[model samples]
Target: MADIRIVDVSLRDGNQSLWGAVGLNSAQIFQIAPVMERVGFCALDFSSSTHMGMAVRTDHEDPWERLRVTHQLMPNTPLQFIGTGLRFISWESQHPEFMQLAYDRLVANGIGRFVVLDPMHDEQAIMETARMFRQAGCKEIIGALVYTVSAVHDDAYYADLAGKMAASPNIDRVYIKDPSGLLTPHRARTLIPAIRARLAGKALELHSHCTIGLAPLTYMDAAELGVDVLQVACGPLANGSSLPSAERVIANLRELGHKVDIDDRALRQVCDYFTRLAKVEGRPAGKPQDYDASFLRHQVAGGVMSTTRRQLSELHLEHRFDEVMAEVTRVRAELGYPIMVTPFPQMVCTQALYNVIGDERYSNVADQLIRYALGRFGRPTTPIDPDVLDRILSRPRAAELMHEAEALPLKEMRKKFSPKLSDEEFILRATMPADQVDAMCKKGASKRHYNPEAAGLVKLLKALGERPRQSRVFIQQPGLTLDIRSAAKEAN
Candidate 1:
């Protein structure tokens, strides 16, 4: 049996996939650190700029401290950071110096590896990002060949791209990031080998979502096709739109005569803990998905879909979802079918939302979309629809964006924030709103431990105690019992 390694993504991709990126906090992750360390994963899909930004925006947790502490607790496992070499926190891209500092601070706070991706699949940009990470002393750098379904994206395209990436000195490996789960087993048979042929001895990894119900099957094909690593998630975080479940993938690999050198006992604990945590938080656990053919048309990723729905709900326009989705497919094609990954997906969704809600199409063009027309992100896979491009560029806003200011350089950027701010704090405060960063600082560092089982039980006890009229209480289950009596009632 040939051996296949695993990289756990429960804390990052799975959390973002199933819970809108707010699922696991620092304490919850810390609770499983040692067990996860023992599970023998090559790395943890640790965090993204969005995930870290949300730490301050939604949870008021200091993500830097979280990573620092996690590194201390799980000293043996490498923590992976994913970046597009474009921007941090904000949707707009940043200057190279800004991104360089961001990457350097990440390495300082325990980010050992970087998954360098460029949403536009720009090889030059990807190589540049990989070099920046290398200069920051990143232990490993994996170039991402983002997979998408389009007339231009094919086996040869990926193979050629992988060859270029392998030629770069800074990139240690290449991974097929199937965010939309569009890779079928049929595609993998040819695509995997084609890419591997040009990898030039660097390892190949497969990271696919279960969005369209094909990733699990595609993963098996990947294993047989000699993918060196399979990125999987634990229970409650796997399946559905996330990656394949580690438990299921391991068992399947073993039955296929492949050796998976992992601790099953610790894996079960990891699964059980996440399952319990999901239930306690009243969060939906990922379930196996059905084949959805419509996914091919839009290729909108799971997280983008989730975020779109949330944003629509916030705007009290939830009922326009189907309309918005239809507009998304149309907008993507008109915009030259850019790969539906970070930034591009956001741009498409925003334009679609505007089209659906406005009186006329292209009535409210997003600055990002306008910038794309001006050749800001990269050359689109195909020329944009002429009419749409004209309309996008004709807008007065587009004219102003044409002469947009460049991002601040490192020394100049430092002038905007207090000199007292550390690199971590300075980056956060500069990229995010000052209020959000201040609120995170006010919350203090997150505690380092979490007891999943005790969470719900403690809430129950607190609820029962709030009832002044209640004197005594008793509870029993198949394997346990608990009884409580008020002091006043006992005295009576």
Candidate 2:
């Protein structure tokens, strides 16, 4: 039996799932890079446009530098970048020329594999994008069959898409992506074989969340059914909404008589470091949960759920979370249940929140919702509710959006920015607020090393040193001592 390769997603998907993509900074990642490199992962689920944006917006770290440095540190493992359709940092679609440049720069910076996730499962669109990415020098193109439990999404549905992707010259692999963690062992019994039979000789990967508590079992079933690889996260980042723990998954696969060749010592080091860092940073550790059937209805992804919670807490309406989720289910149905992936999950959740809080339902429809009705994205699978569609189109702004042309040509849009800017900075500037990008550039290089145990004491002593007229301060611990002196006092 061939050994099942592992792809570590702790930096990208796991961070996004549990920490809303703000947990790991460059220093934290760099400290673990050398060990992670030695652990023999087939690849690192390193970055996506949303994850990259989080680095810039939250940490004020230059995302490009993080990619380049990580690749330098881990020269052997491929770095995977998930492409959410044809967009960049923004949710809105961009012109082909614009997106091509984005892919070109990603390859240049060190992204080795491209995962194309079209939320709607538009086969033609995925193939077209795969072709473009292949031309952009992407080392591999992996197609995603985003899993959801809709009436129309059955085993055969996925099998057909897998066959289509396998036949495409541009797409090198196919993966079943269960962002909501809804795939069950029973489903896998039929789904995995159906897809594998159609994949010809190409490799198949399985990526599912731990949200509903079914993924761990499903993963075992998948391996038994010929899944080529299993995606996992490390230590504290594992479980809850994130993927399965790498250590546990490897152990189970081996017990099942499947060869999973990984360095146990290095894996233990990864778990220890992240567990310590989680304590130091006071970030929430993902805990395995009992299966909850309610999750199948809303189908909001773990990352999107955390983000929605944070947004609600910021507005002092966190207590109404149940109401928002209830509305999410309703809104999803009205919107024809667009698969719960990337922009669709985000869009559905936003509208649900608005409807929950607004005085009138659908009174304050989000532009994304309006754009969907305007056919800005691919058409919805089932027809949207006539009443909901009518209400959206009746709005005055919808009429104007209906006439909006495809994204301005790349050359014409480039004229809007400075000629001196690189493609990377230009893309960020065009999509995100200019001030955020400026702040990212101004922050310079990020710190490259972190000692979790010292983090708290260092921060506290630094705060104490900043006290007015404090000439010197001394602190002692069981094994460490620190003496701080102000610059003025030293000069004196």
Candidate 3:
């Protein structure tokens, strides 16, 4: 039996897919830290710049303090982060010095591993990011190949690309990142070996989603072919659009004569905790799903799909989902078939939504699309449609974007801002708005303790009781009704 390692993604990608990336608060994460530490994961997919932004914007939580707390609890496991290789957290570009500072601060704050990716498959971009990560003292820099299905993205293409990345001195590991869950078992059988042949014995990990219900099969194939690590989520947060269940993966690996090192009892306890938390929060638990063929057409990432659905529903445009998806296919083709991952899928989906709802085609173009067309993001995998490219380039923003100067140096940026600020504060101020940072600094960390085993009713009651001057409360549900007046008010 061969030994295998696991990287847990329940806090990062799993939450992104199952809860729109805004689901788990710092308090909730703190509650599960001990159990997660006991589960014996080799690494924890803990945070990202986007997560930092969400923490500050939504919950006013201090992201740095969250990292400190996590490190305090899970000292043995390495915390991993994801980045776009350009921006720290914002969509716009930042100075190279600013990005370096962000990386340094991440390493200083306990992030030991970084999974850096460039959606356009730009080799230089990956190398530069890897170099910066090494300079920042990160222990591991994992170069990611964002997987997608396109005419130009065949197995040979990926093999060559993975080979180059594997050969880079700055990269400590390489992982096939299938964010959209488009990789099938047959493709894995062929692609994994081709990439492995060029690795020169470097560690290769497989990170795939369950969006199309083939990740389990794909994982099995990769393990059989001798991949080093398998990225998975715990049970309640696994399956659905997330990765397959870790416990299930371990059981399957054992059945297949592989030596798994995880603690099954601790794994079950973590799973049971999340199961209750999902119930209390009214969140959907991850479950196995049948394959959906339409996923190939849109190629929208599992995480983005849930968030997009919610946004459209809020605007009463849920009925136009199919139309928007169809438009995504057309727009993606016109824009050169960029992988449907972070920022790109968002840009494509926004443009498609505008096209579908507008009075005429190309009536509304998002700035990000114009930036993409102007070559700010990077070159496309394939040539964009000529006419569409011309139309996009003809926009006023395109000309402005074309003439924009290079990003400023770190020293000049510090002159503009305050050099007295700590590296963490400076990175936050550089990437995010000043007002948001100030608000987060003022509010401080949340004091709530999120008990995973608390019942939904108990949580609800506790929340209601915390409000001041609440005279009475009423609730009505199917065959249940209750009203309670405040004791002080009743006595008065």
How far is each candidate from the true structure, as Cα RMSD in Å? 2.6, 3.0, 4.0
Model 1 spans with C-alpha error above 4 angstroms:
301-327, 353-363, 476-492
lDDT tens digits by residue: candidate 3, 1-492: 578999999998898888877788888888888888988999999998998888888888889988988888889999999988878778778877878888888898899899988999888888999999999999888989789987678888888988898888899889999988899998898899988888888989999999889999898888999798999998678999899999889899989999889988889988887888887787888889799888877998655677778878999999998898899999998888899887798999888888888997787888788888888888898888998888888988788878888788888878777768887887788778889999988987665478754456676778888997889989888776779789999899
- Write the candidate numbers in order of decreasing lDDT: 1, 2, 3
TM-score head-to-head 1 vs 2, winner: 1
Model 3 TM-score relative to the real fold: 0.89
RMSD of 1: 2.6
lDDT string for model 2 (1-492, tens) is 557999999999999889889999999999999999999999999999998888899999989999999999998899999997688888778999999999899899999999988888777789888988999999888999988888778888899989999999999999999988999999899999999999989999999999989999999989989999999999999999899999999999999889998999999999999999999889989899799898888887666888899989999999999999999988888888799876788899999888888898899887778998877777777889999999999999998888877788799989999999999889888889888999999999999899998787778776875678788888788987778777886887
Weakest 10 consecutive residues of candidate 1 by summed lDDT: 84-93
For residue 399, model 1's alpha carbon misses the true position, in angstroms, by: 1.0
* Residue 272 error, candidate 2, Å: 1.4
Candidate 3 lDDT: 0.86
Supply candidate 3's per-residue lDDT for 418.
Answer: 75
Best by lDDT: 1
Q: Name the regions of candidate 2 deviating beyond 4 angstroms.
A: 301-327, 349-364, 469-474, 483-492
Tens digit of lDDT per residue, candidate 1, span 1-492? 568999999999999989989988889988999899999999999999999999899889999998999999899999999997768988677889989889999999999989988877877788889999999999899999999988878899999999999999999999999988999999999999999999989999999999889988898889999899999999999998899999999999999999999999999999999999999989899999999998998887776888999989999999999999999989998988899876788999999999998999998987778889998887787799999999999999988998989887889989988899999999998889999999999999798778876788888999998999999889888876999989998888
- Residue 148 lDDT in model 1? 91
